[model samples]
Target chain A: MAVFKPATSNLLHIEVINAIINAIVSGELKPGDHIIEQHIAQEMQISRAPVREAIRELAAQDIIQFIPRKGAYVAPLDPRNIEGIYLLRSYLEGLAARLAAPRLTETDLNEMYLLNYQMGEASLKNNVDTFINLDLQFHDFICQHCEHSQLKKMIDGVQLQTKLFMNMSKWHLAAHSELHREMNAHEPILEALRARNQEEAEMKMREHIVMAGNRLLEYLVDNKSSKNSKKEDTETVKN
Target chain B: MAVFKPATSNLLHIEVINAIINAIVSGELKPGDHIIEQHIAQEMQISRAPVREAIRELAAQDIIQFIPRKGAYVAPLDPRNIEGIYLLRSYLEGLAARLAAPRLTETDLNEMYLLNYQMGEASLKNNVDTFINLDLQFHDFICQHCEHSQLKKMIDGVQLQTKLFMNMSKWHLAAHSELHREMNAHEPILEALRARNQEEAEMKMREHIVMAGNRLLEYLVDNKSSKNSKKEDTETVKN
Candidate 1:
């Protein structure tokens, strides 16, 4: 057995946390799946201590749930949770846009414009992952001009929560198309920001967030319905 | 070395986390104050494992910062962070009002009314702690009624980050008066919810959050200036 070591770096825990987060987001670690610390530790060639630390960290963020004497499990995406997250996202993104409006440099506008171009290219090439990445980057770029770390962190946390859902629907061409539409939506926001119209920027950002939420909800509902049908078919065949 | 006892209960970690969180919120553990795992473990009479787990958990939530090779410390509040948090809170609270407007029950209204009454009592008694607690409870009541768990969680997280700053200005009776005004401000929200007027409810909630942010900012500025003056006086005496 490997000897335990006092944690010299939070880096190990963070790395493990990120790995698990990515696994969940990528659907490799599905909701309700048990996470055995020993197994993970062995796989990663580390002590169970760091693995345990990572699991607890993720649990605190509601990304995972731990049951006493049982084990840690990935958290399921509850629709109610999604609704709450989206509501906050809309508000924060709106604020970010408003702040960026007055402070957006020419370089900021150019970067946004460039991001939109890259998004179009990704969409044409049918690269959903690239599209999603660019889309998030574009939003982050806009938020960067806001000069508000707390708002950015809040927004980042909410966005991270939504990433798994977003990734789950990545295979859908319609989702890609919706993302393209979202990219186009940024034009009005960019214009408003460039004009230093805080109200307009905020309004546009709110609308964008609302639209994004609706799109995701639509995808999730459809995905659930299809899943239910598949389960029903399996049950009928058993009968 | 204590042999690790399998966690008897998940509540232990949660309880420890809450204790640490309370300590931070009450200013018993100020920003940047190092958290010694062994010290807390000894005080709580738990093993180092659980304490470490609690620290990791809080660190994940960004309520605490863990530096590699250093140790865990209460996360410091930055003005920019505060600004971002308020922006997000305003939007989330606004959305909560909009959602709650359509679904609010009579019982919800009654609970809020009772809380408002208690807030008034607390303010009258000049109990800052009681008044602040009631103020938070009042807002939380609305959030709960809205039935958006994700939004509620996000809002609660932001609120936790700023609670220290809010408490710092207990000397400002105007802040207490503002809380009274805020309690009354809920009247419009209650009316809008009772009437199922989504727009009105959203408007009222947004205004209340904005006003609250403004009041907090004013208090922080005053506190900062006072501190600055004290520092300047100390420097002059030394010179």
Candidate 2:
């Protein structure tokens, strides 16, 4: 939090928001840490107004939460929330794929193809940041190109929460094997879209999301249980 | 909008927020209409601070929109938006049902049963207001009782959009037969929940929402095309 220096952008509020989001997503700002607008304003050498506005905007977007009388904090990730949001995202993104498939132009396909190629390369090179960036781009492209603005908004909300979950769990699929597996998951979805098969595109998209959610959820549960037992083990040793 | 009387509550901001929401859901506040903060404050015989805060809260919920320099306005309901939100709600509510089945106690089930009974009565009497309230209660109950706070937040958001859709469509499931059909749709979900059958509850809940969404979507499409052709007919007559 202390190290964060706001990057300059045309709109100070937006720039502040993005900087905080980047910080949170990168694990620099951990969950449950209070987000002080004044501190950020001072650090950025800007007025508190933009920083406050940025916090408000982020709060509205569910990336930050303000507790009554407690101030804003980076919201903690909950397994139940992750499960529910991922489930919802599966359906919404599925619909996005369906709507986007038939409407996709050659250029759109080319953009997606390029993104996929870069994602594969990043995965092979074990470049976690590049891989994650490409992954965000791939999903963002679908939401952008989708015909429904409301659907895109919903997907964006889900993605925000997904970032929180990923940050909390430190589950970026950093391992080569896991990254490779995830990279492959996007192909059938793209193929369905490229072939203009709306139903298949929708189904494949939903399947991919659900599969990934299940994998992450399983890991989360395992991690929690292991941590609990480790705490119990510590108690026994102390005793 | 003129008929609205502000409800007295401990928190002026919350009361104002609720009053506006009720007005919107009841169709007193039409879409695209500017919401005057000063007017609301004057009407409520309170200061504008609470009113402004209420508007900001509502804006955060996406139940209201604030345009830069243009002030806040009721966002128009788009059919595409409704389709997207309803799709998202279907998956989320389905998960809630699955998680809630085993957790639902005898009292919870009884409360739902009573609500369902009242809903049927409201429909039989063509009491649209009561029916709509009951419908909201029914969904709110599921979201509230769901184990996940985050999931509850998501469902609440979806419900907000659904309210906007319902208001925009003037859809109360008004017809006796349609109400009856919708009432029947809930029975299977209830039965599954009663039996603690998670899978069945989820499947039935999803089916019910999707069916309702399909009905609404069809009507929206039909209305749009008819409006378009009507415009064409008028143009032809003029020419």
- lDDT tens digits, residues A1-239, model 2? 25558457767877898889888877777666778877788778888877876776677667888775578998766666677667777877887898899899999999999999999898887776787778878888988888765567667877987766755544436642567777777899899999999999999999988888888898788778656422222121110
How many angstroms is residue B203 displaced in model 2 relative to the true structure, after the best TM-score fit?
3.4
Per-residue C-alpha lDDT of model 1 across residues B1-239, encoded as one tens digit per residue: 22222334556776778888877776566676778887777666678887887887677667788887799988877654666567667777888888887787788788888887887777676777787788788778777777766567666766676576667666685444554554465677777877889998888888777777777777777678657522212211110
Interface RMSD of each: 2.9, 3.2
lDDT of 2: 0.76
**lDDT agreement of model 1 with the native:** 0.73
- lDDT of model 2 at position B13: 75
lDDT of 2 by residue, B116-168 (tens): 88988977776766776788888788778777665677678678878767655
**Candidate 1: chain B TM-score against the reference chain B:** 0.82
- Local distance difference test values of all predictions, in order: 0.73, 0.76
Top candidate when judged by DockQ against the true structure: 1
Count of backbone clashes, every candidate in sequence: 2, 0
Q: Give the CA lDDT, 0 to 100, for residue A236 in model 1.
A: 18
